[model samples]
Each structure stands twice: as structure tokens, then as C-alpha cells.
Target: MIRKLTKDDQELLMALLRKEPALNLFIIGDVENFGFEQDFMDLWGEIDPADGRIKAVLLRFYRSYLPYADGPFDVEGFAEIIRKDNDIHMISGASEVVKAFDGEINFKQVKQLFFAELKEMNNKISESFSSAEPIKKATVQDVEAICALTDTIEEFESSRNGSRTSLRKTLESNTGRTYYIEREDKVIVTASTSAENSMSAMIVGVATHQAFREQSLASRVMAQLCADLLHEGKSLCLFYDNPHAGVIYKRLGFQDIGSWTIVNM
Candidate 1:
């Protein structure tokens, strides 16, 4: 009985999301598109009404979401959903569900890296670069500098959609946080972290000026940001596209949790 998530369902969805904040954030931003057809409800699943109590619920975008009260969920139903829709992939809390879809779904280990327990500082980049100034939150005046830094990042042109207006709107919102390393008259490096869930934050758009490379500026900025996040008792998650960057994050205390794969169906 899956159906489109209507405005009437907003309260129910928000309630469900309070229980799974990360998934809530992911879906709310693009409920209409969701990378598939067959309406929005085709992307969601709940325990059968006849099952007495609703034991589980799942939401599918291009990626799938499954949260359950019990340890294991209805994996077979999840598989059927994927098969019927031919959705590229799904993400879930239960490892068992992932394993159940192993043959039909391509699985990659996306590391949910964390720094929950801080260790003694060894080469604390922020500390090492004591002369470097503190990082600051970005504002509208910083838009040009931010766009330049984004340009420095190789993948931005090909992968990202939307205009500066859209980016500005997003940055103006409280949900996305952006930071910049200012020096003299310009911003040399920048990084931003979006809270994907109550417990998880995603670090994104870290870039530096070509002349600023090897000076530890990016590391120092990131170290300071990470320290602040750690102080607030939150964990950070980031995706590394290259082994070199993964090595860098590893030095900063991130572990390979798993991988995520996207397929166009």
C-alpha cells in the first residue's frame, strides 16, 4: 500500500524522521524527484498494518532507508522493492538486509568514519600552524571567494547543479554551515560541514588556493573545525574519492566504514 507522501503526511514523516534524522534530511530536500518514478510512496515502506504493531519502516530515494524496532527487518520485502523499481541501490541500518540483497544489489563498503573518542594530539595541524589565523563562518560577501575556491576543486563543474543563487540560499539557511580561511585580502582555503543527522555531520567542499598548497592551511582549518565539532560531541563523516585524500583523513582519525555506489537505472 505504498503511496505518494502527501502534505497531509508531513507530520507523520517528520515524526518518523525524528527517529532517523539523517534519512529525514536526505529525503526532505528532494521528496518530489528522489531519483525514481512510481510516485514517492514507492520509495517508502512500513510494517504491514495487519502486523499488529508497526515493527519497521523504510524510505527509498535513489538510495533506500530502513529503520526497524527489532534487530532484523523484512529484508525480503526490501529486495522486492528494489527488484520492482530497479532502483540503483539502497542504504540501510541492518547489515543483514544489505547481505540479503548481495546478489541483486551491488554492495560497496562506505566507511562511516568517526572520531567519537578523541586521542592525544600528536601532529595537531592547527596547533602546529599557530601563526595562522582562526577560521571564520562565511557570509554573503564571501560568495565570490567561495565560488573561486569551488572552481579550484576539479569535480565541481561536472557534478554540481544549480546556480550561485541556489548556493546562496542554501548557505543562508541554518542547515548548511560554511567556513573560510581568510588571509590578508582574500580567502585562501575553505570547508563546510552539513549536519546529516543529530549524531553525524558531513564535511564537504574543502579546497585551497594553488599557491597555498603544502602550507598546512587546509589541514589546520580542518583540524580546527574537527576540534570544534568534537567539542560539541558530534561525529563527522566525509566521502573520499581518492586514496590520497583517504590517507589524509586516516591521519586525522577517520576509518573506512563502508563504501557507497550509485548506478543509473
Candidate 2:
């Protein structure tokens, strides 16, 4: 049965979420940063009666995001539970779960994504982009450039459905990093994490200028960023739907975990 989660269940919750860090990045990061009890957020779960382990998990963020994860789920039952809420921005998680959900819930946009992870780097990628643009971590001095890049890149993201984040706040939070390749003072490629925790980091904002594709600029920045995070003792997680992009990441050592889906409601 599905029920609300409380502080009393924190340990039980963390245990389940940690199993697949890549699939549950949002759930793990929010719980780590904001705690279990908050005025605007609520978490619920389905428990397996035989073993008492959580079988499915759901997180609702004030109608902005409702993310779910589980292998075996009663999608219709859970969909009915979420139907009671309003203004839900999206429902996201395993493609099977979310796709099944989109069939039951009215939605505005339905997106399919592939989730992958790299436990170890194949070999040190030569950062020797001697003749190429150098990848550097963005400082507060680089916010405007980052924003400009995002604005242009996002437009091509799914015919204008790409999500845009305030790079301004990302820099202010000081929790994650955005690495980019700059050519003659112009930002061309970027790789960054959208959420992070002590054990994991979720990579997002990964894009390259169309003119710069096929140059491996994205690979370079992503490799460097992943190395840095690995040094800090964090595993890397990312979601993508492009086969070409998946090849690049696999070369750097990421393997497919599963299908992740996002439905804008």
C-alpha cells in the first residue's frame, strides 16, 4: 500500500534511494538538502508486505514536480492518488513508470530519457586540448556568459520545451559546478550538475554549440568534470536520449542504467 513518508521513516527511505543513485538523483538530493519534513514537499511510498522494503517511491514538490521510481507498480492506483493534486508541473522517473503514467494522467509534454552511470573512468582523457578551446570551471564572473549560452541552447531543446535554470542561483548555491569550453572569449560547450549530494552528482546543462559539435568539446568538459567529482568521492549520474551523445559518454565509461521519463503536466 502507498502512504505518506515521515521523519520516522528517514532511514528506511535513504536505504532504498541509495540503491540506484542515478535513477533517484532528485529524490536523494532534495532529501539531503531539505530534510524529510518541509512545508511544501511531500514524499510517499508503496511497501512490499512480505519484506517491508519500499517497492515504490514518490515525491511531490508543491505541484511543480512529482517524481516516481519502482520496478513493479500499480500505475493506475498511483495515478489516481496523484490526480487529487493540482498544478503539478511534471511527473518523472523510469520510462516504463512515467509512460504508463502519461496514459493515465493528462499531460502537456511527454519526454523519454535514458539514464546512465560511470563507476570508473576508462583512462585519463587527455585534457591536452592544446590547439582546442580550454575547459574551465565557471566562476561568478562567468554567469552572464553561461546564461547567454543556455538561452540559445534551450531554444533548440525539443522545439522550445527545454528547461531553463537560473545559472545565477546555481552559482550562488555553491553546491555544484559548471565547466565549459571557451574559444576566443566565447563559451561554446558546457557540462554541469543540476543536483548533488555527498555520494552522487546529477549532470545536466550539457550542450555544445551546433557549430562546435563533432569536436569532442562536450566529451572533454564532461570528462574533466566527472574526474573532479570522482576525486571528491561522488559518483556521476546523467540522463540522455540521443544515441550519438550516449556513445560519447560510454567512451568516457558510462553504462546504461535504465530508461527515465519526464511528463510535463
> Highest TM-score, which number?
2
- lDDT values for all models: 0.56, 0.77
Compute the lDDT of residue 237 as modeled in candidate 2: 82
Model 2: per-residue Cα lDDT over 149-258, one tens digit each? 76687544553332334565666686678999887788888888867787788888887888888877888888888888888888888887789878988988899988
TM of each candidate vs. truth: 0.66, 0.84
Compared with the true structure, model 1 gives a TM-score of 0.66
Indicate the residue-level lDDT of 193 in model 1. 72
Error of 2 at 23 (Å): 0.5
lDDT of candidate 2? 0.77
Candidate 2, residue 58: lDDT: 80
